[model samples]
Target: MALLDTSRTAPGKGVAPLRSAAKAALEASGLPGRKTEAWRFTSVRDLTTADATPAQGGLVVDAAPGVDVHRLQGELPADVAGWLAAVEPTLPNAHFVALNGVLADELVVLHAQGHVVAPVTVTHHGAGEGSVSTPRLLVVLEPNAELTLVERFGGSSKGLTNAVTQVRLGANAGLRHIRVHDVAQASLIGALGVAQERDSRYRSLVVSLGGRLARLDLRVRLEGAGSRCDLDGLYHVDGQDHVDHHLRVEHHAPHATSTQTYRGVLDGRGVAVFDGQAQVTRTGPGAEAHQQNRNLLLSEGARAHTKPHLEIDHDEVVASHGATVGSLDEDALFYLRARGVPREDARTILVHAFLRELLESAPTPLRDELAAALRERLPRGEVTAAMELALDVDEAKGDGIEGDA
Candidate 1:
């Protein structure tokens, strides 16, 4: 067996010391194979084999109000490097982190000083055939500060993307993060790691709509009392596409809270997977955690795998998790059918309704955008046509005999 596996295969670039560090980390943990419980359903075979290329031609982002952006031109800042070290060292996919050291080009450090109502958007789009790019971003929030950070991903379907994001929050800081992956063609392997101090808060909303194979890992460490973390996600896949999301939250201090909720719609031969874990240590007294995953498969060939784990060590902590994968409710669909709703329209309505339950809590403007995007991405089939006809019928009827049926 080769000792230097995918984890240690670092492209020769960057400084020698940094490269050596990456190699050492990868060699220590090694790449996770099929047997790894966290990665059981998703495969990194394509990523390991892709001659990782540095991507070009992505979105241009500038500093927003109340935010300071450092576009690092040469050396990595000490503060940024320290944060990265803290995160990637403990990451399960640290091999990818080491790989990121060589392939990454876009380096930026973002600092939020005061409250900022406007969002800072970073658009990352790739070009060229089978190109690979690593986008590295480090974010820090000073005590009592707040900000909104948005990331949009685009590019070709055959292209592979490796992105790493590191974040740290001072006491009482807050962050609202929104990530939109609207590209229908790109293959993405990305990770975002966060650490929170006392009284801080972190909220993240992830929307995934494209990619031949898309996998993301999110890790949040609550190291302070009164800190909170909330994660919400919506994903849809069709055809032969696949999407996987892995999330982990560690509560190392008392009085911390976290929530993980995600929903998915799969059709055609698409596949989706959700694996999430929340751990409360003995020190994490008064911690509260909850996780839920629900998926709808429209086609017989579509698939979803959901696993939720909650580990608690303290008696004062409360934690629970659940997951379900099923088709649309036949009873509900029957009621719609009886109301003269077309089968296609009924199906689309049910899928959107399932997603809406989660989206309702999102910010109004973002909620509207996400709803529109989901509507556009819904698979069109005979039932969709039937829905359009149903709409036309509703318009002609004029008389509102609509059943709450």
Candidate 2:
């Protein structure tokens, strides 16, 4: 089925044209079928739900954590306003629809003037009725410009939130995008689309900690030669929640490169899925691509599915893909317990170690923030061991201690 067909249903009262267009795009790109190798492990039926509606703007926010919306406003470059005005008309109306939380009353645009040292943060809050919210953002980075963006979504509202971001990176521009999703357990989420230009760099990190059901879709195109892109995500799901990450990187130019890594943790009966595909066409000679997905099941009933795929038409290119799904190692657990570590702490330590790779690659400030957030979200005793082991490793490295010496 096409994405437009799926999003064609009537929207809530006062629906805008952009919201309709967003729905249409979703319908047109409807979930992949069984024949689509990339989607074989994870079904799309559960992700294309149509119950989302426009969020009322009056939700109360108790507090906003790890986010500074004002920073976004301050970082907005003068040219960004003009760019938004130019693209506003070409953007499909469907891009404006909110699936669960209320759409922010305002839209933010950041244009790259030259180089941006400070990161801009955008925060979303949901209160009052449990409903869908759609927030829109348009970003443009001029040639040779650089910038960083941080997006945080957190709220007590029990509903769905669908957000769409449209980005255009000019030739040779560089952008670092970080997203943190910490919604209420009852919330559902969907995010769609991002695009890049020639010789530009787009790096992103997504951390999903809260939500009953969450799906993130990223579509990036390397339209310029020598362009490079990196995508990374980490998700922790417990209880009955479900999390999914779907990514597609297309190399349309020669000498382009792309890398993707997505890791997840599931406990209880929670389910998690990662599906990534990298396509390097014949025109993309000398292109290089790599994709990896890893997941850990913390409980007997927990489930995880991962599929990483690569399609290279150019013989001169380098490409590889890998995935793994498994539970905690019993031998490692035993080793820690025999060393006088508490059983609970031992398990915690192992879980943290399992997830440390992704965090290690995350930006420094973002890494610190994520660490603190996970500390609060994880079970107290269950993760203590992991924390202890992490400290030990840090101390060992700091002290220049060699294990085999």
Candidate 3:
């Protein structure tokens, strides 16, 4: 395979060693192909189309709304610092280097004194001729530590941003990970790998709003008993964009539990794919797992594909998986139109309502910020129509028996 042809296919200079290491990793990890069940929905051919090369682009650090970064800039723990230093050397060879987004060098690490309540935001910006950019992050949560980390990807040029993030959670630690991929009409592809320890909780919420082509691969391992994980994602695609989400949860110890919920909206000729898998090994006897994926299509040409899979080797474990894909409820739309709501507004209201459930499940501050961001992106007419229909529905529901008697 071309991806396996590392020596001749690798790109650029000055990072030869890193590229070599990546090639080894790729070969060791195996190529993502149609034959691979996990990659059945998304193709990795683009990644290996040519020899892998370091992307060229400028990296800028700036402030983005809905993301806060105060905690990452403060003092950090010794172990966390050590880990960051160790991972820093590998940043140059990361695949995100080709995209004109954020760079790994721009990462700011902060130490926590105890439990932290504030959230940190990392934003990406792009300019000029579109190029590939990669953003790398390493986060360490100390023992008994707690914090929320929000990563946002946005760009102005037509380019591809490939990002990789690795997080290590300490024993008895708790982390709330929130990621928002609001890339421009440009393309952004991301892969996130996380390792957790005993009694730690790793919660993640992923929101994909922009990007001409976007894919997220999340793999989480429960290494200790009583360790819990929650994975929630929301995605919206319009125009000709394509979005795919692949998640895998591994229960390595006894008594571990996990819950995953993913929802999406596809419009225009856009396509969306959701593939989720839960693996419970024989050692994980008391493990419990559940996964659900729901999608809504707005146009006849738009399409959505969902697949939920469970691999359970433990007879004592409880597991369930399900997926659903369909368009707006015709009856509901008819009801709204019968009550004087316009057709476009009715569809917009329902679509927003379907997506709001995912956002409402988020933390209050994050949810509010995301709501505003979504509103700003909605077509003005759709937004106006939704607002008017909402008001009309509220008024009609409020005037109970005014004309009944």
Candidate 4:
């Protein structure tokens, strides 16, 4: 792809060799086609044929207290460089990631040494039309440290934003990650990789709202015993938009647990896809994993593809996976209408309730913003004070709900 513009000088000491390696890998694998197994449901034709240029804009970070943020310019940290190098050779679909390594403007790293009470926000602003932005991020949490991270992608509807994020959690560490994609006419393809240590916990909430073509590949490995993970996602699509989310979680240690829940709302000619897999290795005895995906089709032209898979190599592991696609509950709508509620309002309410479960996983402030955004897109586009109060109560319920098998 001619889009690989290596004009921007390499930024760090060990980064040049890494970029060379990535460029080689990208040349070898190239862009995925419709025949690729993992990408069979999604297409990258828009990305390959966009005639795009290298994006000029960089990322902005609002660093939280107790968290150290660094922009890679000169010498790369040994650990960060090592991690980046290791990731280049093993990724299942390494083209976009290799593209990131080849053309990314800079690397943004967030490190937490102790508990961070506030949230760290990283905003990616894309360049103008006919351009492509490759943003790379790495997060590291020290032993017993706690942190919350928010990653937002937006701007330049006519551009392509391809991002890669890597996370490492030390023993007893905890990380709450939130990703929001609202780039209106843009094409977004990204990957997230995470590794957790003993007693560590990782929780993620992904919100996908707008894009012509948006896809995310998320992979998490629970490498240490007692580690746990929760993955929750909500996607809303309308007017010919296409969105896809593919996730894989590996339970490699004893007692490791994970749960994945995803919901989507499609309207008009919009389409959505959810492919999730949970695997328990032979060593992961006592592992518990569950996954569920549901889609609400809002129109005759709307469509969804849902696939949930579970692989268990240990007889002692507990695992279950399921997916459902259908329209809103007719019975609930009838009940609401019989109670004198307007049909459109009733449908809106049910849609909100269907998405509320996953929205509850977002932070309260973000939840409010997300609720307002979703309300604007739903039918009637109205929200009452009582409805807001009810959402408050739901948020107050916190993360106490059971998420595992």
lDDT of 1 by residue, 1-405 (tens): 111134332343433434566666666766677998777888877655655455543545756888888765335678766765665533546766666654554466788888977888887775445666667777889898898888887766577667777888889999988887766676777788898999899999888884687788899999889999999988998898888899999998899999999999998898998989898887646899999999998889989999988988767878889999988999999999999987878878888878767777666577767777777778543454344457657756864356443
- List per-prediction Cα lDDT, in the order shown: 0.76, 0.65, 0.66, 0.81
Candidate 4 local distance difference test against the native: 0.81
Q: Write the per-residue lDDT of candidate 2 for residues 208-277, one digit (tens) a residue.
A: 8846666676777787899999999888888877777878888888889999988887888888878888
Candidates arranged by TM-score, highest first: 4, 1, 3, 2
Per-residue lDDT value at 21 in model 3: 44
User: Weakest 10 consecutive residues, lDDT, candidate 2?
Assistant: 62-71
* Rank order (by lDDT, best first): 4, 1, 3, 2
Per-residue error for 351 in candidate 1, Å, reads 0.6
Look at candidate 1 and tell me the lDDT of residue 366. Answer: 74
lDDT tens readout by residue for model 4, 251-340: 888998999999999998898989999988775467999999999999999889899999886589778888998999999999999999
Clashes of 3: 12
Q: Which runs of model 2 end up more than 4 angstroms from their true locations?
A: 1-53, 56-107, 381-405
The candidate scoring highest on lDDT is: 4
The sequence of per-residue lDDT tens digits that candidate 3 reaches over residues 1-405 is 222233343233323323444555545554557877655766656545533333443333333333222223223456555665443332322333322112222333333435776676666553223345555455666677887777877766565566766666777888888988887665667777666777889889998885666778787878778788889998888887778888888888888888889988887887888888888887546789999999887778877888888998758988888888888899999999999988877777787777778777578668867866665555543574446457657667875345455
TM-score of each: 0.86, 0.76, 0.76, 0.91
Q: How high a TM-score does candidate 2 get? A: 0.76
**True lDDT of residue 371, candidate 3:** 69
